[model samples]
Target chain A: MSAEAPPAEETIASPRPVRGSLPRRLVGRPELGAVVGAVAVFVFFSVVADAFLQWSSFSTVLYASSTIGIMAVPVALLMIGGEFDLSTGVLVTSSALISSMFSYQMTANVWVGVGVSLLATLAIGFFNGYLLVRTNLPSFIITLGTFLILQGCNLGFTKLISDTVSTKSISDMEGFPSARKVFASHLTIGDVEVQITVLWWFALIALATWILLRTRAGNWIFAVGGAKEAARAVGVPVERTKIGLYLGVALAAWISGQHLLFNYDVVQSGEGVGNELLYIIAAVIGGCLLTGGYGSAVGAAVGAFIFGMTNKGIVYAQWGADWFKFFLGAMLLLATLLNWWVRKRAEESK
Target chain B: MSTSRTSKASQTSPASRKALVALSDISKYYGNVKALDGVSLEVHAGEITCVLGDNGAGKSTLIKIVAGLHQHDGGTFAIEGEETRLGSPREALDRGIATVYQDLAVVPLMPVWRNFFLGSEIHKGRGPLRRLDVEEMRTTTHRELLRMGIDLRDVDQPIGTLSGGQRQCVAIARAVHFGAKVLILDEPTAALGVKQSGVVLKYVAAARDAGLGVVLITHNPHHAYLVGDRFVLLKRGAMAGSHAKDGIALEELTRQMAGGSELEQLSHELARTPAPDLSGGVAKG
Candidate 1:
């Protein structure tokens, strides 16, 4: 039944590896469990909860996840490219505070402060990448050091400036009147209202997806992550690809910083802590391997959606809000098991 | 193996047909250990130049030099008869050279079509909207692999899903599609079973037929004897000898590789000398 027509091809043709199978559906993959679990959760929430189906509640989740979602996209890409950036969480806080202080304390224009924040974040990222490539150390170890240093700096400087752990309002700045609209604006569609950052979230996700699956750079990311030595053998620039991934992660953090600023209108010293690992969790749940190579930007975004849905869905179901952390832990464990199975099956089938 | 004969390129081909790759007196140093010492050889177009060496014979070092993974501490490396520098693999690829290293050159998780166009993907848009031409890549990979006698029913499969031999072919086919004028293969069939080795050997012949200057580096003289136009022997960080196809017989090649001359001498001494007679004194008693 599976036989090919002899006349169809001029020659017998070499057999290239193929991944899809229509009939079996599983195709020897292990991730079927997590996929099924996620679907079940979504369906249950949509059907049972009163506020779960409401547009505004959904928007609220999206708004909350937008920051996490943006960071998760690049983290997924970097994970696929075979690296991680631990400094991102603290860097976001540092960037936002820096921007807020520049605009309010130093009386600079909002855009200028935003620009400085982005530039500074990029510098940190580049340094992380530079040391990583040159020293040939795993990015995890290097970025961890950066993470600690940044955390200390964030606390130390915040305490020095105000004699307290938080910075005063950037909302009082002269330029804050016009600056609020670009970032803190709200969008309403029918009965749904979303923070304008959702638009940025969507645009960034779309752009990141394009870069991962549709460009030459995307191919390099896969090659480098798959096997860096082999990639170098075939003329892919391993160091450059790795550095670019770090740069991408840093850029994402900077954007997240901007979102947090516009959302809260105040900077907190302790904000965004523990969030870098959260982004990594989202990427892993999205099917990215911890070792790198073989993942999807779309999958990571979907992962963020799952997180968002559950966060709001639990409240809408009138479940105790204290159970949120437990739910996330369970979800992560399920995803990890599914992903491991899928990889093993993939190896066996090959 | 004896069924083939060289199709002599006519005088009109070029003035003194260029050496597709050349290493003149190339030497490598690893913390005072001379890995390669004054190693020199030339690879020509329309010919398969095989480098045969045993373990630690500088074969790995030489191939790394040609592939642009390592730099020579002492030597003049040239391509197309002109001296040139290849500081990075990207530079080598830019100049139409490609290397297929054993293991890991082909990404396991990426689809066959994607791996085929990796690092040089075709795009559809002019500016901000630019995106990979996925359909084009998928069909072209199918077509190219088909030409090399590899056709997958679906081009969307992860390359890791194929057998080792098939994966090597995909890497080979990728180089050919990307316009690699000179292709260097490092131990392409080292870890294969009999059937897989046969598949890979066929692909090597196919690559040569496609007009690529082929450099086959292997420790197996038998594998080299199959399609090689010329063979260069390396031993202990230096060139031992070189022979054209007509100059060396299969037995001689094996004998050389097996250290036949040294073995013969040991036997000769063993046969000529035995028991010089403290036994003779005992016989008088």
Candidate 2:
């Protein structure tokens, strides 16, 4: 199948010299705006809030960021594949509720509950992706439907099984300590205590970046997102790629769900009602295009970091928690505008 | 008309060798509407077969059948002397048939090297550690494009920045590097400028010179006449005429391509046409 001949020594003169200078190459990166915005936000918070620079405050910020970052990684990937999963927020709750209720009702080990929850969450993801490709509908409509259905099921199933809006505590169940160690344990790194989710978040980001830039699936994601018909014409599996993207989001949701259950020792059926928008906002702030096809995992991590800074910086500055939403909205708009401008300049320079 | 043309093609072609790709009375229908009917074409290795027609003249339908986007409703399609029905574009590529579409050949936002190895990316290592051989792919893409006379300044540039002709050439080079035995090009020059069209046509000729059987679809007769070994004229959904290179002259080909007597009638209608100045009167009012 190797049709390429060995390289010959002949060379032809190019009309233009190679012009990839450091700055020019930087300008073309999708994460350039996110990096600049993160730095700006960091400087702004450090100057405005007296405690923002403290190690304790920084660890808290990272903990907040990690929760969102875990979900943003997969959401960013799905967006790059030209789709969305609106059910992710409620899906997290559904996963936690399923695990807690199954363990309590069956008197099973927490590990078994976690395993069953994983399969159930993946099935829901598969359902969304299968319906989407089979019908060729906009992902917004399909995932929105799944979102409402999961939202309703979360509350109904929990109330029916536990006779309340939340699940019974699984803190005393077998394997609870090990599961908590994996999902919600914190470690003191030198003088600073850091949540385990931060490590999970970093690992997910690294994994996502590897898949995005160094794999065949990564190439297919960019292709399917950028030009689906062209990708299909060249033999890329468009439908399967999209489904895999949705599965990625579901897998991340399961991790986040387990963290919720283990950290709190209970599950609130309505806890994650609007968190899906937060993950998408972090991804967009990170530099992933809303239209799909062009983005980076590092950008999404930066976006989540930005969210963390704003969430904690306001409290440290003594600003009302109500102002948090307003600040987040403004940051999202500014970061997106910066990304659009940078992309335009990059294209013009080329 | 098609019977006589087939006989003439058989006589002109060498009897000792079979065609790399052969279509006989290929027909396609969309419910009740006929998209193509009774169209026959043959492609031989190291030669270019030009399919010339105007818009909506079934040129696209013919390419779709050969490219495995659609199946023919009637007649036979033979590849390397075997009658076959291809199920998908992947099947077509696996059989050494690569089709470069007009506007959908490459993803514009991707880097040139990424788009070059997009679907059939080469991977090294094993299991979870396996990854795309990015360095090898980049060098191979650069070398292959250079071989095709496209000296890119950087393969990392988004392919959208490349001129239409360069993109087409890159796509052609990719097909050749992937060992395509038959290269089907769909209106490669339709959106290009005059100079760009010339550049793309040169690469099309280069693909032919590389010992590939090329099916070139175009509306321009002069471009086809410059490189074509055989010409198939399509009108509406049927074959209007077919000719071997030596059997027909360029003027006759152009005349038939321009609708024969219908073009002559349109010229006569425009020659003495002097309408009263109704627009001038309306403006004065």
Candidate 3:
């Protein structure tokens, strides 16, 4: 039966019959068990640890989260676009080594070093995406190739430059002044100040969120990842979008490099290995499906938060840090299974 | 001459009725294969224009052209009497043309509202400063789905949570909300059951009643008979014929679609074939 239709003068606030909205559903989703898990861990540690609840502790978790969190946002987007970047971890390590060489060994200006690092990382992204689109091979193998190559480069190049696998000090290097402020600087809020990467974390999240939700470009991102054929059928530039996602991921790795290199004066050639999995874990925990077609950037940020909390929380609980991998693996499994159950319920409820 | 002929053949004459879309002489090709040759059809306001074809009959090619997924080699596509070339789905969208794809155009894991506003999101404020008007979209999505006779308890649930028929409904409602003047459905009822097909067909009429033109592509003549205002049959990449609702019979369309006499001949031949020759005994018919 056709109902009485609303007049043209109707207000935007008209009563709707949709039962629960997306935001409301997201808040109540059983799949968001990781978020709950994150909170529980936070509260549990805060109550027991001496300074865990203080702002000082907040800075550490958030600071560390900066690198991984920044990486997680784009990784989540790439995953949503139906691809993966296993090279992202080694890509970061390569950038850090590249930057250290210029600033410490080569005696180049710090800004130049940072610029070269970012450009190189972005280039790696371009190369990965280009190869993926051209060859039509699964990104797993393509990025794995990049991962191994970058890992080897990071090791071989660092040793070649300094005859060692590490750099002692970019601190005494000339012209690190302006370069350090933008990336490695700290912002103090009362007594609980930490690294400036926290700022980068927020900025990147905000930017990624806006692009994912606001722009027309963002719509294409979801469409391409969700169903590449359908997206191509609709005339979306699937290849371009895919390539850009990989590039975005590479840029994220570059940012992570900046955070890591700045926080520690000594740069190790092999530092950020296996970090690709951590970023993926953060994204998956945040609600990105590996199979593509669906994800949330903000959710990924929260997922990174979950990781940050649990990582520090375990230590504050006076537990061995080595147990970190066990907790992470368990959470990943639990969250994924829970997410599957929620999807089933949502589908079944309809 | 062809233009006028096709115009006259379509069920609702543009002069006599409101047509959402009138595609006259749409042709397409893939390599050397002439997929669609001079296909012309009109989808009238609130009426289903069913395009039926057998395997390799260019049905997919035609839908792609009409849906703005593929560029036509030659054609004049007019929406609301304004001649336009649908260069892309975005361009088609500018002319109020939208498509509800077969495998669901909706992002399965996304919320219903997000899926509804996938490419065309509702924003408020000036350009660059505009943010998604979430409340507006959510409420509008709810209200529109309900208007389409869909009763959903939550707008936030993933579209994958919905049934095939429900997903079709959501896609329809989405097309309508995006101000679609013409909605092209690509095999929407292909995977649905009888009851589910009915649900989809009902919405096709509803969309038409709401002043939109709908192109329903399917191989099922029965489904076409239920809601079609015009029927276009394709066989081997050529337009078999176009028939109006008043002039066509459902059985005849089905017979033609299934190659009625061919099936009958095959059955008769099967019956006449020796059942089993061995064992020294001929099986009596």
| Residue ranges of candidate 1 with Cα displaced over 4 Å | A1-9, A12-35, A46-50, A343-350, B1-18, B24-27, B73-76, B262-285
Q: Model 2: per-residue lDDT, tens digit, A185-213?
A: 99999979999999999999999999999
DockQ of 1: 0.35
Candidate by candidate, in order, the iRMS in Å equals: 5.6, 7.7, 6.7
Residue pairs in clash, model 3: A19-B153, A20-B154, A21-B156, A22-B156, A226-A293, A347-B161, B46-B208
**Candidate 2: deviation at residue B151, Å?**
0.5
True contacts kept of each: 0.53, 0.57, 0.31
Q: lDDT tens string, model 1, A71-90?
A: 88888899999998898889
TM-score of 1: 0.88
Q: Put down candidate 2 lDDT per residue, B51-84, tens digits, no spaces.
A: 9999999999999999998999999999999999
Q: Score chain B of candidate 2 by TM-score.
A: 0.92
Candidates' C-alpha lDDT: 0.80, 0.91, 0.78
Off by over 4 Å in 3: A1-14, A17-31, A43-62, A104-106, A191-193, A213-219, A232-237, A309-321, A342-350, B1-47, B68-97, B126-128, B151-153, B179-181, B210-213, B270-285
Better of 1 and 2 by lDDT: 2
lDDT of 1 by residue, B173-199 (tens): 999888998889889989988778777
Q: Over the full model, what C-alpha lDDT does candidate 2 score relative to the true structure?
A: 0.91
Q: Best by DockQ, which number?
A: 2
- For this target, which candidate reaches the highest lDDT against the unseen true structure? 2
